[model samples]
Target: MKIRAAVLEKIGAAAPYAQSLPLRVQEVELDPPGPGEVLVRIRAAGLCHSDLSVINGSRPRPTPMVLGHESAGEVVEVANDVRDLRPGDRVVLVFVPSCGGCVPCAEGRPALCEPGAVSNTAGTLLSGERRLHIGETRLNHHTGVSCFAEYAVVSRRSCVKLEADISFAEAALFGCAVLTGVGAVINTARVQAGSTVAVLGLGGVGLNALLAAVASGAREIVAIDLNEDKLALARELGATMTVNASDEGAATAIRTATHGGVDYAFEMAGSIKAMELAYLITRRGGTTITAGLPSPEHKFSFSPVSLVGEERTLRGSYIGSSVPVRDIARYVDLYQRGKLPVNRLMGEQIGLADINAGFDRLATGHSLRDVVVF
Candidate 1:
């Protein structure tokens, strides 16, 4: 079948992406769903930093790849072996496709499924196949979910069936931003009521963390970001206080205000500097969690003595250390009940043709969770 999709022909393009135009919206051929796979008519896809990382050459992946992972769609067809889902079912696409037999999957950590990681790194589906092509040229899949198109063929393991009543635009966020952000607080940190918390970066993921912190009953939730607009939004979203990362006294002010730092600090900006700041804002015996995906070449250094003396815990969360099949449903339930309030994080809705310009907004750190509606 022929489909219109945003294809990233190469990486490391000069910014002002509206001009460089790294992603080309062009027609491509999509194969039918294989066994254990499903064909989905993409209803909405969100532009996230993970996608921006690829465009800026920070997080490198196989190029000439369809460039979206956070998306929601309606099932159009299912492979024979996939009996659990059928056409017309609304679903959220998960970037990592877990093979149930893998070690991580068996341990209730599907996010780290060995096969899923391998396939994602290789830019293939769980079955190790490419279903996208342009004549004789085959294009790589983006984390087994090349969803920046009208349609996508993905492994069943890469999808979570949605039972909640919500728009595809709202549901698309659960696939990535909501999952990563909320999951970081609820699943990874398990933030307890009355505990002090701080979140850095305030992008889609960071703001979601702020919302989750509020839902979890945290006593003091501090929002930190370089963008003043995001800080203002954070204040409205129940943050007890907001700090500008660019402020010279940002760390000192947070430490003083929170009485020597927060119990938990999350780094969602995907930058080494954010990670360092998150670590600094964690009080003694507190934990600092980083879900940011900076360049693989980037490294962060810290004093081992601080870990031992302060009894500080530093952990890395991938997809919020989430079990998508379980967490996505639970988070959706929270959203419907007005607990998560993810809708407040939504930004502009755009068409596929304006994707390059959309990315420019993302690169500038001024956009919210912008969606491409089909």
Candidate 2:
């Protein structure tokens, strides 16, 4: 079938993406779902930083790929031998497609599924096949979910069913922002109630982390970002404090405000500078978790003595270190109970044709979670 999709032919294009137009919306061919896969009609998808990373050549991946990962859609078709899911079910697409038998899956860490990582790096589905084509040219999948298209064929493991009442836009946020941010707090950091916490960066993911930290009963939630508008929004979303990271003395200011340092500091900004600041603001023996995906070429350095002497912990979180099957439902339940309040993280809605402009807004920090509503 032919469907309209956003295709990124090259990377490292100049900014003002509306002018550069890194992603071209074009009609492309899609295959029916193969075994262990399903065909989904995308209803809504978010323009996330991970997608931007690919377009800017920061996080390198094979080119000529359909570049969406965070999306919600309805199942239109299912392949033979697939069970437990059928047509008409609402589903959110997860970037990682876990093979049940992989070591990480067996160890209850589907987010680290070895085969999923391999497939993502190779730009192939879990089965090592390409299902999208442009005339005679085969296109690569984006993290097993090339969902910028109107329709996508993805592995069954890439989707999780949603409740009937949840809007596609709301479900779409869960696929990435919510899962990664909230999971970073609850799963990766396991932040204790009444703990002092700090979240660096106020993008979609950072805002979600702020929301989750609040829900976790964090006593002092400090929100840091270079954007003042985002800082204001964070305050509205229940952040107890806000800081502008652009200040040269920002780390010193944060330490002073927290009365020494925070118990936990989370780095959501994919910048080495932000990671170093997060580390600096964490109290001795405190844990600092980073969910940022900086380029492989970039590396952050810190004093080795701090790790051994202070016994401080630094960790990286991918996909929030989530076990999607177990965590998505739990997080959704929190949303329904009025605890998570993820709805506040949503910004504006756009159509598919406005995608390049949407990306421009994201790059300029002019928007939060911009959903492409079908």
Candidate 3:
């Protein structure tokens, strides 16, 4: 079938993406769902930093790929082997498609499924196939979910059926931002009530972390960001205090305010500098968790003595160390109950034609969670 999708022809394009136009919205052919796969009509897709990383060449992937992972859609068709889901079911697309037989999947850590990682890195579906093409040219899939189009064909393992009543725009966030952010606090850190917490980088993911911290009953929640507008929003979203990352005394101020730093610090900005601050602001015996995906070439150095003496725990969380099938449903229940006010993160709703301009806004670090509404 013919579909309109955003294709990243190349990477490392100059910014002012509105002008450089890295992603070209063009017509492409999509194949039918294979066994264990489903065809979905994409209702909404969010522009996230993970996508931005590819555009900026910080997180390199195969190019000429359809560039979307965070999305929600209605099932239109299901392959024969996929008996659990049917047409008309609303679902959020997960970037990693776990094969149940993999070691990580068996250990309740589907996010690290060996086969999923291989397929994602190779730009293929769990079945190791490409279902998109332009005449004789085959395009790579973005983490097995090329969802920046009217339709997508994804492995059944890449979807979490949504039982909650919510708009597609709201459900789209659960796939990435909400899962990564909320899961970081609830799943990764296991933040206890009355514990102090700090979150670095108030983007969609970071702000969601703030919301989760509040829901978890954290005594003091500190929000840090370079953008003043974002800091203001953080304050509105239940943060006890907000700090500008650029301030010279930002670390000192946070340490002083929280009485020698917070019990848990999260780095969601996908920058080495943010990671540094997240570590610096963590108190003795505290934990620092980073879900940020900086360039693979980038490295962060720290003193082992601090880890030994302070008994500090530094961990890296991918997909918030989440089990998507279980966590997505739980998080959605929280959202519907008015505990996780994720709706406040919604920014501009745009059409596919304006995608380049939308990304330009994303690159500015000023936009909220912008979604492409079909």
Global lDDT for candidate 3? 0.94
Model 2: ten consecutive residues of lowest lDDT = 157-166
TM for every model, in the order presented, reads 0.99, 0.99, 0.99
Global local distance difference test of model 1: 0.95
List runs of model 2 lying over 4 Å from the truth.
none
Instruction: For residues 188-244, write the lDDT of model 3, one tens digit per residue.
Output: 999999999999988889999999999999999999999999999999999999999
lDDT of 1 by residue, 92-191 (tens): 9999999999889999999899999999999999999999999999999999998999999999999999998999999999999999999999999999
The lDDT per prediction is: 0.95, 0.92, 0.94
Give the least accurate 10-residue stretch of model 3, judged by summed lDDT. Answer: 356-365
Candidate 2 vs 3: which has more lDDT: 3
Clash pairs (backbone) in predicted model 3: none
Query: Pick by lDDT: which candidate is best?
Result: 1
Candidate 3 segments exceeding 4 Å error: none
